[model samples]
Target: MSPLNSALFKNTTNDNIVHPDYFVISGFAGIPQTKYYYVFLCFVYALTIIGNTFVMFMIYIDHCLHSPKYIVVFNLALSDLCGSTALVPLVIDTFLFKSHLMSFHACLTSMFFVLGFITVQSFSLAALSYDRCVAICFPLRFNDIVTNKSMSFIIAILWIIAALAFLVAVIYINKLSFCRSNVINSYFCDHGPLHLLACNDNTPSTVMNWACQVVIFWLPVIFIVSSYICITRALLKIAAASERLKAMKTCTSHLILVAVFYLPLCVSFALGGALHMNARIINMSLASVMPQMLNPFIYSLKTDEFRESIKKLYRRKKMHITGRNT
Candidate 1:
């Protein structure tokens, strides 16, 4: 059989009348061997959720963390949680049972959340870069403009934009007929695989998909990087060496987070799709999980105010527990 035919028609019924109720995920690394990696995949998924949740919780419980930067940070954590939740569980099911079968609704649901949160993450990072730019470039005017409430409002606006774009794309995708093959070449229901599965003239969905990808993905990356460039230029004018160092320190964590999030995505896009990821599941998992897992660490390590807040929260909790026992 030809390669395209082989990939498309695998595990499909011979009947022309069959409308698929369940779809299969031929994960990048498929079947038996995939099971061996289940434990590690689960561990990565766990770290993604636990680490992000801990940071989000820390931000929520501590009033000191209620600043503009941390508000954006909280939204980033929320995006990570949504994205990981959508993909990892389905992947675990595919690996553990050697069964890649997913219901039609389940597949679409996964596609929606995974892509939605990706949009969320991209715009959130863009907002973070903008915040950093304002602080460094117009330090005096930053207080008047970008307050905590304003940051939260900006995040809300971005979230609404992402959701609307993703929602329209998902609805467009769902309207496409899928009489061809149910075996998608992915670990879960990703856009490319679904596009391949559609038997109709997919021009509309394809156009919308690419449009959303460019707008929600590449657009935000460009904006963030541009903001940072302007930030660096503004910092160069600072007369005091000590002040320059302090300004650079404020940006370190956000810059690192941006790189971590975008690098893997760039790799996957350059390679065609995540299913075609070079190292298969391992590389793909790392790309998806690492940024979320490492974000809290970057913030804690670089920002002394955030670090102290975490420490103080811990001390307070410890005292509370001690008093309760006594």
Candidate 2:
């Protein structure tokens, strides 16, 4: 059976020929058992949504987390929630329900937002690195430097940059004639998959994608790496053993999370423009889902307050149900 003849190709209304061998490399492909695969995917989706939602609620409802320490975490949660929602559900629908009815317009919308939110999440990490730097490096000025107003302004700026990146890609594609096969290799429409279908010269699209990738991924990563090094060095400079230990504890966990989240992205980026179609699809799936899966566990679990909040939230819900039953 030709990959193109699969359900996704049947919906292709254009003259472009869908590649017969082009299978979407997604989470579904990673797991062999379709039943267990979807069950696990659903589990990840539920955990991501619930965990991030809890983080958001803790930041918003709990006054203790109103400080700048958790403000970046809250914003990071917001980005992860939106990013995962944009990518995960569509993949589930395509693989689990066998609904590959994403039209060109719908594909474009989904791709735009997924890229936007993921970019926001990346930059939010950069912002978070800066936040941690301030908290550790300049304890005296932490409050004054990382005010609610300042954090809000930084978040707004990150969103604006992300919006612009999405707009540019959308506008660029809007001008191109998508006369080739419209069957996107991946479950969702991304610039890369859609651009693969373009009949016209894609030099500009390729260049723009590279440029944006550099700015969005690499630039922030540079800042994150450099700032973290400085932060570690500064922490080491502290004289007191207990305070130094506490600082190392914070920095180590955060650094590990940052490395886990960004390293795959660097690998993907290094693969560059000549990557095989299937390889690209696999990388995209991993990059999109892994960070969201790891985030709550990595960032929030060690925090006493977040754990307490989780316990309290579930305990209250259980109590309410028990009371009603009794």
State which candidate has the highest lDDT: 1
TM-score of each: 0.87, 0.81
lDDT of 1 at 40: 75
What range of 10 consecutive residues in model 1 has the weakest lDDT sum? 9-18
For candidate 2, write residues 241-308 as lDDT tens digits: 99988876776656766877788777777786778656666676777887887787776777666777
Which stretches of candidate 1 lie above 4 Å from their native place?
A: 1-19, 29-32, 271-282, 318-326
Q: Which runs in model 2 stand beyond 4 Å of their true positions?
A: 1-36, 271-280, 308-326
Which lDDT tens digits does candidate 1 get at residues 1-326? 35553443322343422235778877755435555577777887888888888889989988988889889989998998888887777778776776677777687778878878878888888999999999999999998989988998999998888878877877777667666677776677877667767776789889987888797678998898799899889989999999999999888888898888888778767775435343654565667667767877788787788889888988998999999999
Model 2: clashing residue pairs? 16-180, 16-181
Residue 84 lDDT in candidate 1: 81
